[model samples]
Target chain A: MKTEDLKNTQDYKYGFTTNIENIRAPKGLNEETIKFISNIKKEPEWMLDWRLKAFKRLQVLKEPNWQKPKYPNINYQDLYYYSAPKSTSEKPKSLEEIDPKILETYKKLGIPLVEQKRLNGIAVDAVFDSVSVATTFKDELTKQGIIFCSISEAIQKHPELVKKYLGSVIPLSDHYFATLNSAVFTDGSFVYIPPNTKCPMELSTYFRINASETGQFERTLIIADKGSYVSYLEGCTAPMRDENQLHAANVELIALDDAEIKYSTVQNWYPGDEKGVGGIYNFVTKRGACRGKNSKISWTQVETGSAITWKYPSCILQGDNSVGEFYSIAITNNFQKADTGTKMIHLGKNTKSKIISKGISAGNADNMYRGLVDIKNKAINSRNYTQCDSLLMGNKCGAHTIPYIKNNNSTSIIEHEATTTKINEEQLYYCNQRGLDQEEAVSLIVNGFCKEVLQQLPMEFAVEAQKLVAISLEGSVG
Target chain B: MLNIKNLETIIDNKHILKGLNLNIKPGEVHAIMGPNGSGKSTLANVLSGKNGYITKGDIQFNGERLNDISTEERAQKGIFLAFQYPLEIPGVNTNIFLKTSLNAVRKAKGEKELDTLTFLKLIKEKASELGIDEKFLSRQFNVGFSGGEKKKNEILQMKLLEPTLSILDETDSGLDIDALKIVADGVNSYKNKDNAFLIITHYQRLLDYIKPDFIHVLSNGKIVKTGDANLGLQLEKTGYTSLS
Candidate 1:
């Protein structure tokens, strides 16, 4: 590679916003614009009416100012509410038939349409740019009565399921981002495993935001019925663009009696340039509800990208004898900022939750771990344990932890522990002395720090997340 | 193979090595005996390019100046310094670390890397030579290892890397006589006409197994006296107050 190419490689990776025809409003957000989006997607009359109600609620809502390092007010009118591959009139049935430009973008991000053949048991839905390209292993999943498809396709094929559980966990006006997602959300994944049938393979969705000046509001809903089990993985990467983009995703999951769901995310969005110019403002709301006795739901996320991230994937323990868990590793480097954690709300008897979070800050980045655990008066014998550890790679970075606990139940046990530490130079020297380069040493140390979180991922995605950690830390090390 | 000239070092604004000068030729063994806080361990660290302050010094190895290189560079150039306190690196297997280090040295020397089978054989042979159990290779590096086991593992690395200049910093500090003999025997087997040894210790017990031609007494960061193996015995009996 040429010297010039090396500099631009990092540049183009984050700045290459794809050229695609989009159905967008003239400029900003208004009731008319919301109605325009609903009309373009050809939504039913009730959905359009729902979008209007959300838009009205958004007018009264105010942007939260409690977060550290305030961002310039986002011009709602400047964002394109909708974008899709203009060349594709119909979704491709096979990986080969997908648009070449769209496929090439995912390839550059190291997530191709084809599974890394070694991981044969995992099914992948490759969503390029704005739409899902091809859903793999559908025939096999169908054999077990599992419905895994794009959310849009699910709305067309299984509307009853979508309508029944779409906004159950996160109400339309739950948060600012969730409100926006409920308004103009385009495409995400839908997974429904039938009662008593275990998912035959890990289901995954790879998301890419390829258009400039666009906001990606994808809605994902996963349902595991009685006595069923499923593990799902989600990954994302966006090409570099000078124009800051917005991603407001809403993910809701429902677990019925004796059912279990594991959701893992490796989020590597475009985190702007080293100087922290134009990148993704990733604000997402994900929540799961254990609605039946002995149900379980867990969320594990590794966030290594995004210029500014505001996310809290939470769990509502509303089922007796249910279990909830959240494992997360968030990394912020080079002017990036992350304020992420999870919330566990216990409203049922004998409910339990575990939260383990690891954050790494390098360069001049700032990261914070903010979490909440609440036990209601009816939640008898509710229990929770939370551990948050932050690793600061350099003295220039900052790490913070904020945990909130509220309990009205007399028999609840809640504990919280947090620690902030810097990577000791002596440790680096020791690792270097063992023949690992500075980058490798950092990767090794960081990986060890995050092993707990990564292990929660599906085996195949766990390996992929490990490699992403190494690549993401490149150039940040000595 | 190793030369130190008026080596003056300081750490945290306090001097550690003051006007210390020593030399070791190929095929020779040099033992440094001193009281606590003497410059013996500092000498080993300085030779291995460890970071502290060198207020005044000149170090040459194999006729090449050594102060400007990185610790890893010095290591790749056949200078091995067994740390007094080997760090515990969890999640990194001992075998992986050893192979990576060996390959780094080999690559720097323009030699072919050893394959897995050959590497395992060498490791087994070296482990047996040092009386280290085979199970140690699969365990995390230095994690949960006893003090003697850590020292032996350091020796195991030295045996694998086969550095031309080996500095054992207090390798005999926390070892029993049996472990000390095993460690000393490991060092003795690695000694050759093409390599040199710089053994730094507070006591003279290790010299009984691995004899040194020249013994030096360091006090207050400077070499105050130089003698033969008898000097170590004298220091042990008389202590540094008389020598200083």
Candidate 2:
């Protein structure tokens, strides 16, 4: 085989850039850039003030270096904070009016944004570059009193809901990356399910980063009101480039009295080439709060891409009899590094939490699971169960798990289980002897290792996540 | 159905099967009885195309050169090896693994693969022959299974694949007498004029249930004696020491 052809085989299968003109903000993170972002969105004055506050707080916060994966310092002044497709400058009224190139991108990614070819039983809000181009099934969702639209539109049409929930979970002065997202964040999906309602279809958002030298800082806010239930899914992919792009998204979820929120993410951004030349630096802050009694929130993620990942989708069980659960499968291969897990905080009486994390590292990659389970003094009879399993492929890779458990209440209980294992050659041989090829054997075994976490995803996402689990481990086996 | 000539197998630079020779035809059941460290399992592994073995000499299966075929391809072309200890794969449902393995072999042979419903029906019948519980078929593949249950699973796989040549590597080592009968019954029901068996064991008891046409006494790294089924009974009276 030619060297070029062999190298292309290892490249991300979804590596294609869409050529489109983008109206970009000036390359900087100064107050002017923040004001420019706010004006471009035609935001209200209060929102602009909110952005300035976050930008002011961001100046004093130091970028955290405690993560295991380290990269060169980001030139905040050299990066474009906002890049939106020119056609989306005046928000398109419908799918017919949206730019065809943006629709084509989503179609190539197997998510048809067209009216007739839409995915069945699901509503999708396609976010291309730094703008939410089109959101489907809005009318149908509106009939059921569910608000599903882009955060930019939510700010315009449903400001009260946005104002009531935005930063209510992850506050403006939360941390470095999160505060940066709050200052100049672009478009992302926003969901609000009213009380005593069950969402009829799965609500989803597809994120694509196509602009060069632009950081995608999208913000997602979901609120499930009293006695309401909603399952929201987010998927992301990026075009392969030679320069590392930053994706710092802030996703905040809130569940009210007797409400349940299921949030799932299948993150398959462009991981760098074999030598780790360039890829997405995914530093995201995702947190959910069960704020009302008898509320529940579940987070399921299948993270398979990004050159370096620093993310933890955590949950706060703050209401009486509330529940929180996190199921994740993070696979890093070919010079990728991930320091990701979740935290469960029990602060209410009789609260409960469960965490199941599976990390698979291969091809000189490092995968770590750092988690915390804290039971406060007020949380009498609280219960927490955590299981962390790591699977390593080849001696060149590494897997690490760090679990912190604290129980201040004597009546509360926290149980932890951890196991570190290598992909057994004998198991692969046995499967091969049963007629499975080496690649197929590895895929099957790895899928088995991630079964528990995969089961937590929606049926539509579970099948795709299972295949991603296999594809992520390709070339790691003989 | 199978042929091996001067098959010298070395694992980790340790020559185990030094110049071993074997031949078997259709509808024939061959048993190899030996003491400990007689290279019994090595021969089975070599025939199954397992790794870590540096092999020299020719092995032909169904008239094709076996040395070049991969382990999965060998099974696709009708060579089956029942392992002594079935490796446990957690979280892989037994039924799903069986269906995948069966379909892989079937697809390689250019046969249409069976769908899930048909596969379930077919496997249910086969599992019933060996008395495997319906719940065990849904459990994780071989994980937390008893020694006898693991052996039964191997036989179930052997029956599902229906290979022309089947090699049993100490399958009766941990099976009780009742489980032995079930395994023997499974083998007996699957026996046909187009298929053959190569049973490797340390005892002659399994041979009594599923009698072999030829009994080969293996010692050190090669077969030292070859006779009919009656030889197993004679060797039982006096251990492998007499043959060596």
Candidate 3:
């Protein structure tokens, strides 16, 4: 089969739009727009002050250009900073009371909002566009002293908890995109696991982008108290459009003494067409801080969408004997571009971190892995190991790895290894000779390439992520 | 049955096989012996439909022309080639690879695919029969396997696939006396009246274990002589230089 024939057979399955009235903020980014977003959410005075400060900082910040992916200038003022479905104003008391169209949208996305039809034992906080539509299993979570809700409601119901840890890990002046998100962020999920308590079930959030010409800036904050444990999963998707959309999200995690947090994400935003006309520009900042002794944090993500992706979920190991781990599989196909990795900073004694990253690029896409490992002067006896692998399917695609390691402590050890490989024609011929077709052969080989990273994902997400990996690489080889 | 007439194969603008002809009927085993650069592997590649080979021939397999068919289609049609140097595919378990190949061939033949339980049972039995450790089934395909183990793996695949015409390319190379017997026994157990074997080797040691009905001397892309099993012993006494 020809490459063009294989390309023609692939179509985005979640490209359909949901028609609903949207209450959008005035198009543009400025102090007034930030105020408008805060006022709509009825945020507290201190929260408004924080957004104002972040907006002020964002004004002087410039978007970093030292990455592998290149794109045209982004006109920040041309994008609507905030947009929400009209039904969000009147909070629905039950799933049936919610707008059927919105319910149907989630249903079509395979994330049914109806409690009975949804995956049992998993609590969901569904965020549509810029607002939270519904949060299920809240009563049960409350019974177990676990607080899981949208960030907006968390600010209203648990203001003290929200204010204590909101930018503690990732400050408002962290970076360009993060500062922007902090200023104009609308809604995201928030979880607070109490001390010495193990969460009863997996906490999940489904994010959807339906409104056009809007930028989704969500702020997620998760706090695991001392001796607590929690696992969180996030999934996102956007509608197909002729104009590129922007998604700048900020996620912060805090693990206290003896606490552990596991965060997993499967992002499938709309990638531009084969001609590279329209898609989502995903620039996200996700960071976690192990603030107390013996705390741990693990981040597992499978990124397979967006026209341009710039993300590095990082960890700051501040507690003695703490551990940080990162496992990622980022696949780019067609006109997509992704530059993602992780950063591990050891600030305490006897800290350990491990990084595993797999990148697959096909079609005309470009994928890069840029990671950093820093062992501070106080981090004696610390150890870090990093492995990054890249697989290029077609000649036109590109894969790059840039790793930076700095060890200030004499007793610290850091090791970094990287490899770039192409799919072997001999291997493909061998598979073909065993009665497997071209696509099946490619899928099998690519799956083998990404087996390490895929094994890190949760059970349900692992299966979906494997399928996404195969779908993203369709028509990449001839 | 397999037939080839005026078979010529050119790779990278170099003619590797010039006017090669051969015919093998069912229930028969044929051994092709020659020195280095004798186009033994090229014939196996062309017969299995590998790329980068331009051919001028009328090759018929089971009464159907084989040139136009794809590699997978040819395999589905019951043609198997045991590679001289089987590629190691890391992260693909041996059991999974064999099961997928078996199911693909079965599905193409209009047979029900084997479930995990049935496939495991079949593969374990085959592995034990071939003297392969049960632990080898869980490892990556051919990765970290010794040369003898890799050859055993190829024969294990042939047993599971149950192809009508099996071509063993250099199956005897890099094997100890014990390893050679295990591989030969694997082939002997799978042999039947409905299937045929084509063994390509550089030595007569392999033929001593699995006797061939006919021995063809392949030299410079074409067969120079044809004889019975005694011909293999004669060539062992006098190398290809004497035959040429």
Candidate 4:
């Protein structure tokens, strides 16, 4: 097929908006908006205080400008800080009570909320437009002492757990978007695995931005107690709009002694049109803390959406002999821009971290991998290995790697490798001679390039991620 | 089964294959021997329909004009070129690559794709026939492979793909006597009366194993001489300078 024909065939499939009554706090950001959101959730006074403090910090914090891709000015007040489906007022007791339209929307996204139609061996928390619409397999999870519910419900039922772990990893004084997410964040999935119990099933959260001009500020927190293990997956999608929507989400994870948390994300939000008219501005802050000895936190993300994506899912290795891993495949097509990578902070002895990032850019898009590996003075005998690879599909696209390594201890071992490669005609011809067309050949080659990171995802997600990688690069090569 | 008439291929505005003409019938083994820059590899590339080359010729395969079709279409019609330097595609497993390639060819031929179990069995059989172990199937395609191993892998692909017209471009380069014999045996075993072979090489060592029906001497972008297999022996003894 001609390259031109292949171009723009990857229109966002999840761009249809669900028509539903919304109970929204008036468009804007202020102390009142935070208080209003907290009041709607019926939060305690301490939680309100936390939001007010985060709101104050956000006021003082300026939107960071030190990034690769530049965008038009964003007026924060023009965006509705909180917009929840009106059906969320009286929280549904089961899937039957939830609005059928919301359930149908989830079904369209390939995430059926019905217990029988849901994915086997996985519990899903469906969050739509700042509220948890339906969380499936709740009883099954609760039977195993696994508290899996919305963050709002978690705060109401187990405030001590939410208060103890919230803001512990990412404080209100964190980055600008993170501070904002802390202030008016409406709802997200909250998972807690008790001590000595491996979670019976995989926990997943499907986030959808439905309301127009509403910023999605969802906060997700997961805590795995000592000797426990949990594998969590998060997927996001949004409707296509001419005006770019804002999504600033914050995710925090804590793994206690001998615990492990495997977090996987497949982000497929609307990436705007061919002219880059409208899309999501995804600025997310996700971090995991290995707070106990021999703990492990592994992050596997396949980011292939948003017009402008600025995210770095990082890990803080604060326990002796703890291991942290970040495997990512970030693809930018058309006029999209992605500045994503990971940060590994080694603060304990014998800590180890591995980062394998693959970035693909096509069609005037720009993709960058900005990562930092910091081994503190107390992190004796720490080791880090990072490999960042970039593949540019067309001459008009750009791929950049900015790796920052700060090692205060001489006993630490750090190895960094980066490579920038373009789709070579020779390779394409070689593949063509073996009976594959240009698109198939490009997909195969790109999949090979990202095999290391793709292998890190779970079996089902790996397949989806591979297809997304191929679709994102369609028509990227001539 | 293959014919080239007045083939003139220019790459980068520099004439590479100038009015080269050749014809091969089914069950024929043809070897084109040449020195460096003699356009032997260019002939193979052009026959396989690689891009970036301007060609003015009548190249027909199976009664169809091939110049207008894409490289993959050419392959679907039974054209295979064993690269002189096999590309190292990291993370593409050798078995998967071979399976995909074979399935692509099969699909074009209106055949069903083989299941994973069937494919694994087929590859294991073919690989062991070429003295390759199962472990090589799981590794990245040609990544960090030794020269002999790469050449053997090319032969493996050629055997599994089972093309009607196979073009082995300098397959013996960088091979030891043992590896060369194995590769030659692979090609000889794969050759049958229904198919053809076009071998492009620098020396007569490969010809010693797989006898060629015709030996064409390529010099200065065209065929200078055509003779029997003994001609290769004579050229090995008396260089191209003597022929000129």
**Model 3 misplaced stretches (Cα beyond 4 Å):** A1-5, A117-120
The reply for model 4, stretches above 4 Å from the true place, is A3-8
Models ranked on DockQ: 2, 3, 4, 1
What are the lDDT scores of the predictions, listed in order? 0.83, 0.93, 0.92, 0.92
lDDT of 4 by residue, B104-150 (tens): 99999999999889999999999999999799999999999999999
The per-model DockQ list reads: 0.46, 0.84, 0.77, 0.76
Mark the regions of model 2 whose C-alpha exceeds 4 Å error after superposition. Answer: A1-9, A117-119
Per-residue lDDT value at A181 in model 3 = 93
A best-first ranking of the candidates according to their lDDT comes to: 2, 4, 3, 1
Could you give the candidate ranking by TM-score, starting with the highest? 2, 3, 4, 1
Per-residue lDDT of model 1, residues A1-478, tens digit only:
2346436534434446566565455567877777776665566777778778777787778877788756788888888776677655467777777778777776676664674453567787866545676787887789889999988788778878988988889987887778878887877899999999899888889888876777888889999999999999998788777767889899999999999999999898989888989778999999999998999999999998899998989999999999999999998988899999999999999999999999999889999999999999999999999999999876788999999999997899999888887887877777666555666677777887787888788877887788777667666655
Docking quality tier of model 3: medium
lDDT of 3 by residue, B1-244 (tens): 8999999999999999999999999999999999899899999999999998999988999999999899999999999988889988888888878888899899999999999999999999988989889999999989999999899999999998999999999999999999999999999999999999999999999999999999999999999999999999999988889988
Better of 1 and 3 by lDDT: 3
User: Model 2, range B1-244, lDDT digits (tens) per residue?
Assistant: 7889999988988989988899999999999999989899989998999887999999988788899678999988889999998999998999999999999999999999999999999999999888889999999999999999999999999999999999999999988999999999999999999999999999999998998999998888989999999999999899889987
Q: After superposition, how far is residue A353 of candidate 2 from its true place, in Å?
A: 0.8
lDDT of 2 by residue, A286-305 (tens): 99999999999999999999
Could you tell me the C-alpha RMSD of candidate 4 in Å? 1.9
Q: Per candidate, chain B TM-score?
A: 0.96, 0.98, 0.98, 0.98
The candidate with the higher DockQ, 3 or 4, is: 3
| Estimated TM-score for each candidate | 0.92, 0.98, 0.97, 0.96
Selected candidate, larger lDDT, 1 vs 2: 2
lDDT per residue, candidate 1, B67-170, as tens digits? 88777778888888788888877666788678867887788788999888999998999898777889999998788999988988888998998888888999
